[model samples]
Target chain A: MRILVCVKRVPAPGAKINITADGRAVDTAHLGFTTSPHEECAVEEAVQIAEAHGGEVTVLTLGPAEAEEQLRYAASVGAHSLVLVPIEEVDWDPQRTAAALTATISGIEAAEGAFDLLLFGNESADAGGFQVGVRVAHALGRPIVNGIKGIDVGDGSVTARREIDGGFEVYEVPTPAVLGVKEGINLPRYPTMKGRLASKKAALVTIEQSTEAGGQLRERLHRPVEQVSETVILGEGPEAAAAVVDVLEELGVLA
Target chain B: MTMLVLCDHDRGTLADASLEALTFGRDLAAAAGVSCEAVVIGKGAEGAVGQLAAYGAAVVHLASHDVLTDFGPEAWGETLAQLVASCGASVVTACGTDRGNEVLAQLAARLDEPFVANCREVDPSGDTWSLTRVQWGGSLLEDATLTADHKIVSVAHHVVEAAPASEPAAGTVAAFSPDLDASLARTVVTDRVVLSRGITLSTAPVVVGGGRGVGSAEAFAPLEELAAELGGVVGCSRAVTNNGWRPHSDQVGQTGTRIAPQVYIASGISGAIQHWVGAMASKHILAINTDREANIVTRADWAVIADLHKVIPAITEEIRRRRG
Candidate 1:
């Protein structure tokens, strides 16, 4: 039961977003990148599945050189191996990202063996494009159970629950399948210091081949006008309550 | 040959989301210089599919089967793969609701095709089609081309406004029966629990959400009572979900369900950009918070700087005591 968890390095959920001065891309100079929120859950699921079944878990990521940070993080958190496909050119869309990931996974499979299961987050948080997982599955020609919230593996097949119109719909798919892990599927684990250290030293298998997939995305680089403001949080002192009360009443809270 | 849109339905009834999907599908396919068809998937949705013609579908492919009695993702994905192949649709589209996106993702995988989710708009340019998807939680737009002979797309909910049917045009309803492998499904839902009488926050006209500032679980009672009186639904911020006081389904934020209602009354919410992205699409928003400097006050149409503990109970009591 070999499993591959696909991930992306994106600005953290709480990270302050600053568009580049040119307004074509997010300004990452001061921002710290981490595994996408949902990807963390996906990686956790992979580790849990690997621990439950006898297998190894590998993390795959596609991005610039700095994207390897997330791959190293994955290795620290119990993944057996990490693979990074470099898209040195900034702003690779999902099609290209999926292609690069496929090429890297193909090389890995050719060397080792094909994966039994593939896991992905519902979507990346920063880019918020929910396309890579499905695109990868399609490129590989595998059966897929998507956006699964509840999954139980047995009977040589995987049973998963996908949230439907009102409730949930259960689906059974054979092994050698791709499935996107939905939010609330499981609890994500934090990387330990030991894991972090191990991951940093872990060599990432980088693939340089291009998968001839094209899609236009340069238009997103344009900037939008924003009226940014700030709120100074008064220190959490005893007087803070008095100050807050005064402010609230001045705004007509207490008549 | 025209493109086909899968119509989602509830036991013999059509979902409004499906209608919205139908409208989007019809408009998109027509813009691409092709006619549009619809496939209804659910138990006994054959009759309901016939009404899709009002939204411009020329054919409503009905796949009513016993194996489909339950919404099996594998079975449905297989059925769609077969239907798409047989119909030879250049593209298929669905509403970006939870179910629509889930099923569409599976179908895209099964068809071995690329998919674009939460696309806000699609404009055809000769042989190529351009789409603008909500990038970065709707903060920015990613305008790109489809660049595929076949593509699956999910339109963002409410982004493509649903217009009334222009005319009642009759279309052919073909019954599509496909074989489903029951043993392949991983999990099966044995039971369902409906909260707040099944009034989902996404469909509610008025949503009253509570956050960490609500102080305690007991504070939700006022919100629930108020929602009940207003004939609306109760929602919450991610803080409540993080606190484990509410299920993730009730959470309203960037990662949670995005809702746009007529009126949104936020209580105790700090108005984080994530929360704002979810509910700021509402027609009107009223913020109730003790912090006059709260971001919600600026994003909201109206601001009431008050302690929700006192203001909410009073509002509910006033409404209840006011009577019909």
Candidate 2:
């Protein structure tokens, strides 16, 4: 089995996102970057599948040269190979990104062979366009589903689980299919010291590429107006418990 | 030109998100000086047709094909694409749910047009529509332009509240059947598995959430006790989920569940922007934390400065005592 997983290097989430002076991109001077959460999980899933089924896992990314850091990190976690489609821009619209990926993937498959499974995060953490995987799958004329949390690989098909409001729906697509994986599908393993040492020597195959800017063009990026409020402090520590109960009562939930 | 709003439903009931999309599409159509029509696809969409008309749909188009019994991205995309051409729609829109964004992207790919997701604002005055969309789950915004003969977009989830029109439309329902190939059923939903039955995090009226300050997996006991006493569910921040203290299903953040409970008791959570966007939807927030400067505390309607390990149990005890 051959599994391919796509990841993006994004600024560590949970911090306040700041825009650069040019208002076209995020300010990265003081920010640390990591693999987007969902994609990280995807890497772990691919590695696990490869380990169980005795296959090879290849990690692919579309970002700047600095994205090597993320590729190396994936290597440390157990990806057998790394491929980088290096671009100069901070980001591309979904259409352009998908086009570049589709082209690059076709080249890779021609040189080697078609991967049985192609995995992508349901959406990127920063852009969250939620369309690249769909476009790529459509361009390649392959079946794809997004928001998948569970995967059961079979002889010739893969069954995926998509979480709905109350339950999960299952979809079984044939091999050589694409899937947009969501976070929480699996817990990613930490890189061992031996794995880390080996990753430092892991060579990267960089593919320089560019595409015409898609129809969606970014004009500027700005922070949303933060909502300010005056918090009423009831009390401190355990003493505040009674006040908390009173407020809950006022909200009519304590009844 | 007409703007076609794709409405979603479950079984027979229209989804609230679909109403929000209708409200957004109606307003956008009025601004662009175009007619607004709605399309509902698949089984049981007729149940939502009347509500769609009430929400300012000039005409409701019910599209049903034998293959559309279950949700399928390619099939729905094919249906919407054909409807756009048949209806002469210049713009297509839907709510920014997973399915909403997915189907529109599929449609955009089919039509070879640009599709924008989670848009907060749109300007239709120019030849290329200028749009402001949410990035980082509402922490940041991007001003953009969509250059296409056909504009496809999804309204940011919960950014605009669903509102009914003061004057209802004719509520006319028209049947639409799109030309679909048999191969489009490859990605259709095949089976369903019910994991749990009861109040989910999104539906619960009260949510007692924990964060990094909750310390360890075992320490979540007090939070669980408090939540159970309050007849609510327990939620966690991304930090807790990363630490393996709680499952991601219990996480309240951009990548997790967007909860709109009656009251969200946030304890020990620093309220990162991702987490804030999800909890911000709650009607009321009560923050309990050791640091006064934490983001959740400042934004909370009420707060308590203390250790969650002590405060959570005390709150549970106090509530029980009061009930007795």
Clashes of each: 13, 0
Regions of candidate 2 where Cα sits further than 4 Å from its true position: none
CA-based DockQ, model 2: 0.80
TM-score of chain B of each: 0.90, 0.96
lDDT of 2 by residue, B228-319 (tens): 99889999998899999998888898888889999999998999987998888899999999999998999999999999888999999999
Maximum-DockQ candidate: 2
- Binned by DockQ into CAPRI classes (incorrect, acceptable, medium, high), candidate 2 is medium
For residues A1-255, what per-residue lDDT tens digits would candidate 1 score against the true structure? 899999888875341366777666787787677787678878888898888887899898888889888888888888988887777666576667777787787789999999988998888877666767766776786666566777788767787776653566666677788888866677667789998888878867877867665544546543234344343343232233344333433444232
Q: Of the true interface contacts, what fraction does each candidate have? A: 0.24, 0.87
Question: Which one wins on lDDT?
Answer: 2
* Candidate 1 segments exceeding 4 Å error: A13-18, A21-23, A51-55, A139-141, A193-198, A201-203, A215-218, A221-255, B64-88, B102-113, B176-197, B215-222, B228-231
**Residue pairs of candidate 2 with colliding backbone atoms:** none
Residue-wise C-alpha lDDT for candidate 1, range B302-323, written one tens digit per residue? 5567787777766665555435
Task: Quote model 2's iRMS.
Answer: 1.3
For candidate 1, the per-residue lDDT at B186 reads 36
Q: For residues A121-227, could you state the per-residue lDDT of candidate 2 as single tens digits? A: 99998988989999999999999999999998999999999988778999989988999999889889999999999888887888877787889999899998867
